[model samples]
Target: MNNFIKNLLLSNFNKLLQSTKIACPKENLHNSNRLKFYNPGKVTYDGKLNCGITSYLTSFMLSYHNIDHKVWLSKYGFGDYLEDHVHITTNSGLLIDTTYRQFFIDYRSDGNCDYYKYLFETCEPIFVGSPNEFDLLKKSIERQNIKVFGSLNQDIKELSDFWKQDINITPKMNLYDMRKSNEIHPTLLVEIPSLIQPLIT
Candidate 1:
């Protein structure tokens, strides 16, 4: 991709990350702990956040911006068990994961999670192209004698349907109607326009 588009995507992504509140529920502490394999940092646990939320928020932002992207879920095998992580792939085949930083933060501070550390430090936005290409990259990593986590499995679920459903339920028309009827608080209504403008327009 050209630098201009790359910068635009990066800027919008950072803004979305700052604006959106992506968090898991502290009430589901047990479930949250189970997903910690994908979240390797103190901020994630303390903030009650997980990789799923990050993927959702990223998808939402991309949708709002009218960016052509698909959410990819990959299941990884851990001996007899499996775990999943979701991330986005652009129409042009670029991979983007705003949450990979969590792993880096943990690895930098604790000097553990070497695989995740290497991944975040090396890959730009993570893997590019299809899952097969991703598999090749993983194999390359393993060939280096690196103990890569999660052998990729066949179960992959695309999240475009979920995004469509969410958009349908939370239509911008309702927000506009609420604002027009004075049903929404003035301050919130004011804030809503800036955020929803892209989706509506």
Candidate 2:
């Protein structure tokens, strides 16, 4: 990594470490109020908090700051179970993981969780080079390749639709289908664009 990028990552890392508050609840996973706690407003008020919430907040911050990046998910197999971890990728495909500190915190607080232990030992602040360099650290990581605002627009719409369904009823759309769906409300199309201002020539 170049000195500039190294310094940039360190600065951002320190800022996030000092400013962001941890919000992932310690108990009652199923009965917890997810929307109330994990929404953008709450996250902004409390910090990124967890993997999924952190990824969304980081992505939004990157866009607002005019940083060229994409959010990527890394899936790991722990015996019969698979878990997804989210991080960010620069325009050059470099990896940036701002919330890695949480893993260390969780591991130190409770060593019983094997996943956090593995992550705390393995994860680094930034991957420090190309996507291939980052890939060398983790096996079976999936990059969403969402390099532009347009890519996120559809996924956001599908997510909105999925959430609109009845609480007891499951949506007909599968996870993959919802993520890749293209149809969106025209009125909501301006949301991302407004956050990311156009570059001046």
**Alpha-carbon deviation at 137 in model 2, angstroms:** 6.6
Lowest summed lDDT window (length 10), candidate 1: 156-165
Each candidate's number of clashing pairs is: 0, 0
Backbone clash tally (model 2): 0
Candidate 1 lDDT (Cα, 0 to 1): 0.41
C-alpha RMSD values across all candidates:
9.2, 15.5
Off by over 4 Å in 2: 1-5, 22-49, 78-80, 99-124, 135-201
- In candidate 2, what are the lDDT values of residues 43-107, reduced to their tens digit? 21212235454454445445534566666656555667644556666675566655533322221
What value does the lDDT take at residue 178 in candidate 2? Answer: 26
Worst 10 residues of 2 by lDDT: 161-170
- In candidate 2, how many Å is residue 39 off? 30
TM-score of 1: 0.42
Candidate 2 local Cα displacement, residue 55, angstroms: 2.8
Error of 2 at 106 (Å): 13
